[model samples]
Target: MSSFCLSKLDHPDLAWLAADRAVAADDDPTRTAAATIAVAQALRALGHHHLALTAALAAADPADDDTVRGTLHLQAGLAAAEHGDRRNAHDLLDHAAALADRHTGDTDPHHTGFGAAAVQTARSLAAHRLGDTAEAILRHEHVIRSDGWRRLPPEHRAAHLVDATRAYLDTGRPSRAGRALLDADRTAPAEVRSRPVGRTLLTEIIRGGPAAADVARLATVVGLTR
Candidate 1:
């Protein structure tokens, strides 16, 4: 699926596409921010690392604000890390973390972004990437507890759960990952819940059982034309 479809406003990589579309379509600031972030996220997911980085940079300096610049750096750094470019990732992440630190007096969760909660989640993701296990865990826990998350749309919540599951798996907590994935599947639409990762995780949980139907359904949901 296209990255635009996957990146929801409620999620951190907030509006790469919406922002861009807004500018292109009607010059709406709201759409511009959303489209820019959405497109940036989509590019990152599709492995267009440099494109993601560029998009983020452009979005950050729309009005040349330091805060927005820092946020974009944070996102670009994360995307770079995911693409296996640790050097650039570290540089960019450190830049953002530094800005966040300076502004909030130690990378405080209440910095600035789409929402306090979303900003905090982004910081947590950065910490997770930087191997700051304790901070990452604390921040993620806080996110789970916050009203912001509870008030999000179902698809947005599912996306967050997917990130949480990945974080759990990364931290060597497979059981937690499994449970989180199941929860995400429950909240997601059938089309989203039927992806390979979701299906495979479910199949593994119910090994040697009647989950073949589920697996098949997953294949169909993801439109695996094979």
Candidate 2:
């Protein structure tokens, strides 16, 4: 049997990609910052909380007060959300959003929506878990329209699409969820495609028993190995 797993969910390649890009673009501080965020997000996704925290801290700029502080808070908020600390997560996320708003008029590109979509998405998940369906739906809808997803690297964009797909599913809108899953599947590479397909299949499973041929087809498309 193959030792590789489709559900393993590690992001070593993303970390490597980010690090390589950061090194190659050392002259561009904004690219470096963005790469740092990517590294942090990848680490966070892979359950390396300490590494993610360290990366976030390292990404902070001592000179640029507002933007740097906001970025750090946003990173911290993401970590907090991952750890299930909703209250602190929301507080830090809101703080980051406010800070971002304050720096929006600045010409610097780094002052943009730094992790706000992730924060809102986390909040939406929390709200859903807490049975606050309306708030969850509203937050997810807002995040779906946000520039954060559009601004992300293509891989991260696919990942966010998966997240957004789940958000739609949690709102009991299976059709919209399926569409989001399809989008993610279309954009994702062979190695990453299965996650979205698995999610889509779960809906099918819930409704009734999905055909083995259908499941096998999706597995083939997704390359069921990690």
Cα lDDT tens digits for candidate 2, 1-226: 0111212244455554655466367765555555566566566666765666666666656335565556666666667666666786678678777876676443445533445554566566556544566787787678768876565445545665566556666666666655655666667644235444445544453353333444345545554422
Model 1 agreement with the true structure over 1-226: per-residue lDDT tens digits: 2334544323324344443454477454433544455566666656677888887866666533445556677668778766667688778766776665555422323123533455566667666666765677678788878866664456656766666666775676666665666667678754245444555554443443343444445445545313
Each model's number of backbone clashes?
23, 1
lDDT measured at residue 98 in model 1 versus the true structure, 0 to 100: 67
Residue 26 lDDT (model 1): 47
lDDT of 2 at 206: 38
Q: What is the lDDT of residue 86 in candidate 1?
A: 68
Q: How much does candidate 2 score in TM-score?
A: 0.58
Clashing pairs in 2: 5-226
